[model samples]
Target: MEPKININNSTHFSWLSCWPQWTGYAAALWSLLYGLLGLYWFLGGNGFPFGKNDSRAEMMGSFLSNLNVDVGGPVIAIAGLVGTVVAIAMKMTWGSRFHRAIFLSYAWIMSVTLIFIVPDSRIVQNFAYLFLLHFDLLDWRVINQVFCIVGGFIWGASAIAYFRLTQNACGNCGRNDATEGSSAKATAKWGKWFTYFAVIMALPYGIVRWAWALGIPLGTNDSSMVGNEDNVRVEAILGGLCIGGGVLTLGLIQRWGVIFPWWCFFLAGKQIPIWFVMVPAMLMSTIITITGLKLSPQIIFMMVNGSITNENWGQFVPFLFWLPWGISLGIAILAYYLKRRGRCKHCGKL
Candidate 1:
């Protein structure tokens, strides 16, 4: 049964709902700006263009050399593209639980890939050795892995629940038997495609991790690096699997939004708290998309010209400026839409 959303209920537009949107917007803006600034610093020669001869590149190269793999530029670009597409899709399809579910699942897959592929040891060691000399949080690996895993699960489950609620036919909306609609059919097809894509994407990392976990020597990497890599891969694989399974189940039953999977525990079969789901999802999406859009060009230019050095860092300031402005404007637009949607056409509550 599809749950009847009180779209016209003014009370539903309470500050609580608005706050998450605002918070997400703000965080996204700041993160995007900072990331751009960071990239500018990297490329303009003032900081370190990742592939150039700067301190940052040297550090990264050394780290990668130790890991026996080249740092992947295309993979990073692909992740950015996926993140941007999903974010924009979410914004355009705001009230549709089905679209939101698909977007959320995509975002989770990207996040998991980032965690696994980025090499946490490199990030942690770089920050500690190059940026923060006095920090000593090495033993917090377990805690960090736990947080990432939990976050991935939350995102995957949220996607499932939202999709389930939207497809439900027995609810107050009386929109059941709606599967014959083209939109419904298209969405179902997309769900299947996404499930297969996520599983395929996750397989490489999953195989390596599983082998490593069972005391099999898959490679000669350091124990810490191996463990971190395995954890990240497993998190991504599990998250993808959960989302794929949940969506498939929902599609089979024609249930769109009502949560039925007891696996979600506290949040199972419940209307997701917008704050917990929408807020973080929006923020993360905006940050990654905006940052990528702003920085990729500059990074490419620097890479081509081989001029990423300290002298060019000033050029990055523009990226910082554009990112915050863009993200803030995006948030404002979303807020306006939410406000407009608050006015119920059926009941005129707002």
Candidate 2:
């Protein structure tokens, strides 16, 4: 009951149908990278990760501090080697439950762990500034995380796709079954919910930000920060844009989101590229949200408990939207991939 895919990257390859077949290889590659890094860490060196693996910011360093480097290095290397093997084994047509779990574990751990490596200056700038303004700086701190996210997304999404495709017997594409249509409908339904939740999560954050720009002190402990007068116009502009953009994000599940309106002129009615929507949504929202959470403990304490503290209540404003924004967008991205599973532009298949 596998649906037929009508797309090809070359005479020998039909990527649309063959994409999932490569997830295992991708997972193995990531595992190998981790293994090598582990080996490097074992060498009493600091660059286990590209930049800023210092004691303060390094992930899980505090807990692992007591473990001698001599021992830790070997342990890490062993795990990497085992992971590489396990990851490689799953490259088969159907991955086991254990392998699926492994994929999810590494995907989450590896990708999220990279967020901790972001610098202090980047942390203080706030999420919006980092995402909107400082985005152009081509630093490896950002690059590493991007790789982490991409690797995780690929392994995880591909595994799910493989399961769904095989489960539906979609591998037997010759037989016409209700699987494709039913699965698409289900995926789309989830997509709608994801988009709806994403809108709700983002709407409040944008509204509060907009309010801040208008000098309507939302939570800043310092009134003068609002009185800067310079921010009044600047923040207002940013707020308006955030409001508009948040609304536009809902278009991910809407008709206009998929096909541009007539006003778009030449691009109107054409299917928008998935990466156009997904790349920004995933990277920007993720980094912003993590920046909100992954920074220093003092800041985190204030954000979470600021609402209760008599002083500096405004510190809590960022928290109100940060988590929801991250979760909402993450789920929304999943829904997007689910709905558009087989519709690859390069392969020209749907």
Candidates in order, TM-scores: namely 0.31, 0.68
Residue-level lDDT tens digits of model 2 in 158-219:
45544444444332121124443444567677768767776676665456557666677665
Score candidate 2 by lDDT.
Answer: 0.56
Candidate 1, 148-260: lDDT as tens digits: 33434433333333343345431112123443222333344444444344333324433444544444445334455344654545434433432343333232223322233
- Each prediction's Cα lDDT score? 0.38, 0.56
Model 2 TM? 0.68
lDDT over C-alpha atoms for residue 147 of model 2: 61
Question: Candidate 2 — worst ten consecutive residues by lDDT sum?
Answer: 168-177
Model 1 per-residue lDDT at 224: 50
Model 2: pairs clashing at backbone N, Cα or C within 3 Å: 2-170, 219-314
What lDDT, from 0 to 1, does candidate 1 have?
0.38
Return the top candidate by TM-score.
2
| lDDT score at residue 335, model 2, on the 0-100 scale | 75
